[model samples]
Target: MSSQKEKTSPFMAKAIEAALSAKSITSPNPWVGALLEHQGQIINVSSTKKYGAAHAEAQTLQGKHLPEGTLYTTLEPCVAFEGKRTEPCTQIIIKSGIKKVVIGIEDPDPRVKGRGIIQLREAGIEVQIGDGADEITRLLRPYIKHRQTGLPYVIAKFAASIDGKIATKTGASQWITGEKARDTAHHQRAWVDGILIGSGTAISDDPSLTARPKNLSPEQFTQPLRIVLDGSGKLPVNSKILQPTGTIIATSPKSEKNWQDSLTEQGAQIIICEPSQNGSGINLEQLLQVLGSRSILSLWVEGGSQILGSFFSQNLIDELWAFIAPIIIGGDGLSAISTTGTSTLAEVPHLREIVIEKLEQDFLIRGFTGNWAP
Candidate 1:
């Protein structure tokens, strides 16, 4: 018998590539891709177009008549359900005369779960599951986490020197990493559903926080939502983040009404969150839930120490990406994470599945926290 990799890896890779083509544009919906094959030859490959548009399976099998063959998808075909915008992909496949269906993983949404697989099998179609499961799971992690926990997958990203300093005592932080790493950072900013920073970073850096990947036109990339954690609403009215249309300022009720109103006039939406139990800032968990309710599947946190500390202390961070440069700023400089609430080495949080990649003069250290994967 042929091994599973020999049978499904190539097709699944193609499907995943197709899915990534639309990943940035599909939010609140998983980026899915499908490939239709006849005999040993491939017929067509398609991916999700946009939010609320036709899914990958439907896009692949619709309006096409082909010989009985196999269908490979990065995600389980969705079944018909209430509130779904389009026809169920299972029905479409059954009518398309496809003989076999190979799926990457089951849909995590409660509405679909394993129902799509059952629907296919009941129609007398051969079904194969778990091909390319690991890769597909990583690709759909944000969507899976959102559906499973009603919380966006949180990723904390920062750049620091070899000695673990983010900036000097004077707060100058420009050009910490090389050009290649900075380019990669911009690409990451474009990939997530939202990009977040604390008010301190906003006031000190005065960053626009826009994703401008090198050589890519604005039309080619969708700008992720800009979010700021400002419990006191102390963000300056002239801050660049406030100029964006999709900016959200998470503040506490104690914030000044005039400051909130001024930011509102500048196209920023103010979300009032309860103060943390320690009375230090707004509740991070509550803010995450609010983002999840708004269909934010992934959140990228670019910090200025205090915000990173809050997230790490609350154990709200799922993944971390640290870009380490070759230079050292010594102990007097600001650290990447202000506090981790650990008094001993044993108490420090550990990362799993660590991956390190060299980018010019910088090294990117990435890992998942707790039981989180990918």
Candidate 2:
């Protein structure tokens, strides 16, 4: 008999392709795809739907009665666990009369981990793993990061001049990049679960922080949640971000109650975070934990130096997107990133797998930080 790996390879590719179709639509839950095959013929293919809905396997097998077949899934089928919102996919697959199962990767979630595979095996179902694990891992990076670290996958984005300055000495930073780069940035904003900025950016830019890509209609994409890191609660109550219902203000315990209440009155949620050990700002890790608990799997950080520096200092950033304009700003201009306390070249975070793209006259440089892959 041929190895199970060989039998599963062809189906895993189709399964991964199906999963990619649901990208950016499923948050908190990993976007998974399922395919059912019988006698070398494709039966059905399904991908995950919206959050809090049926999983890929359940969607594919539910309400169907068929002969024994092989089921290919991008992720391990989930078993019933406490606090689970939906029915377990493992049970659904067993009931659907699937005799063999092919999984791309085991879920990193502690709740299900290897238990789902064990359950299938106990039911006398043939299980095989691998083939498209790397692709699935890349697609589920945010979800896996959240499950393992209790922190959202962070992507830092910024626009700077050729001289690496974000703003002129006078703090004029309106149109650093061309319209094409800005539009691409908006599309990225729509892909993430949240958009974050420090208080300095909040005060200086006063941006609306909404994802409004010109090519996408309002109904086609939902606006990401806006988050402001205001340790001292200095963000003005009238800031454009505060006008949105999904805005969150992360403040330190020292913040004024009146200011927090005023922000709350504006329909923004206020989360009290512990102060950092350096006494500079609210604890970023703690704030990330809160975001993870709330099911924010991915976050985009549009910074004003300090926030970018903080995330770099803590090694929290997974990816970096830098848009460099052709113009040059003088030495007196503000730098794109503040001091990160790196005294040596080796201490500086080096990005890998660098990719460059041209957005009209501007150039976009994208890379992964640390051990991040994709």
Candidate 3:
């Protein structure tokens, strides 16, 4: 039984894996549940549901005799009480005769930041942390981000034709990629905390912004933050996006009224960009910095041609996921990007590296920076 498990404190690792599976349980509070075992015997198990629900530690201590100095749990013990309950998780662990604590992911909420570990250490509890919690932690990031940033991971999404046109000559471009590619796009949304698009695209297309093809589980799509980039501030106040999860307006500093407080009142976050070039949209680098400072660890730039081109020219892309539609449109409309300025393969910014994956039709090209264009 001992050799059957794998990777760092097998009991804790397995418990973390089990706890991480609750990523979809967002509504009714984050359900952080775990099981404890020592010397191949089930000692106890527990979970946290809603605010007043029995704490994971409380349930863990249910009807059991624990061995002294035995390690317990992957979630930090709670200290702060919400509503009418005041049972701190620290006191419970100490009372249970459990001499050690093992946490999976650090509590991301700043209010309770580091308090769990501090209390456990002060009480002379031997603390051990699980190693493989990152994967599960990342999966739970969607829920954590909502509590902290008031906004989700703002990923920009777009699809362009061979020549970079989002639409054709008459401007009627519906389905450009195959079913497989389109399906993949929706799945990609699961990784992002939110979806962002320009007001122009929103007004022009009126996309629902929900994960498409309907592959995601119900819990996955229910909480993504939706954003709209409207530099001129032309979006309707009662827009559809504003009705549901509401819309985050990416406005410039010029729109002083378009700051965070106002947007927050309207269930939105006002993102201030660094002004658009030629009085158009804001610079992508500055835009990303603003989002990154807000703790948007990862982002996806949905393209419309000019937007993708700007990032390409500036070489700000850390990773790229390009979907080549099976069929190519030889049109005089828009191109993926105009590739402005003068340059050949030699003149453009040289990519240090790239990995190419051949899909059913198009190629998925991922590129890296800092290298010369040789």
lDDT of each: 0.88, 0.86, 0.58
Model 3, range 1-374, lDDT digits (tens) per residue?
Answer: 01122244666655555454443332324446656665676576555553455666667776655745354555566776455364777777777667766776566655565788788888888876644455335445444544455433333344555444656665455677666766777766544545566666566656666665455676543444566776656665555666564566787766656444555676766777877666667655566556655545445566556666666666555445666665656666656654475656677654334666665665555554441110
RMSD to truth, every model: 2.7, 3.4, 7.3
TM-score of each: 0.95, 0.90, 0.62
Worst 10 residues of 2 by lDDT: 1-10
Q: Can you write out model 1's per-residue Cα lDDT over 1-374, one digit (the tens) per residue?
A: 11234234898889989998788888888999999888778788999987888999988887778747789998889998988898889999999888899998889999999999999999999999888787777778899999988999999999999998898988889979999999989988888999999999999998999898887666556799999999987899888887756599999998999999999988999999999888988999999999999999999999989999999888899999999999989968989998845779997778987999999989999988964543
Clashing pairs in 3: 156-302, 157-302, 158-302, 163-335, 164-334, 164-335, 164-336, 165-334, 276-281
Model 2 C-alpha RMSD to native: 3.4
Q: For model 1, what is the alpha-carbon lDDT of residue 244?
A: 58
Model 2: lDDT equals: 0.86
Q: List the candidates ranked by TM-score, beginning with the highest.
A: 1, 2, 3
Cα displacement (angstroms), candidate 3, residue 150, comes to: 10
Error of 1 at 187 (Å): 0.5
**Top candidate when judged by TM-score against the true structure:** 1
Residue 238 lDDT, candidate 3, scale 0-100: 51
Error of 1 at 120 (Å): 1.3
Tens-digit lDDT track of model 2 for 139-214: 7888888888777899999999999999899888999999999999999898789999999889988999998888
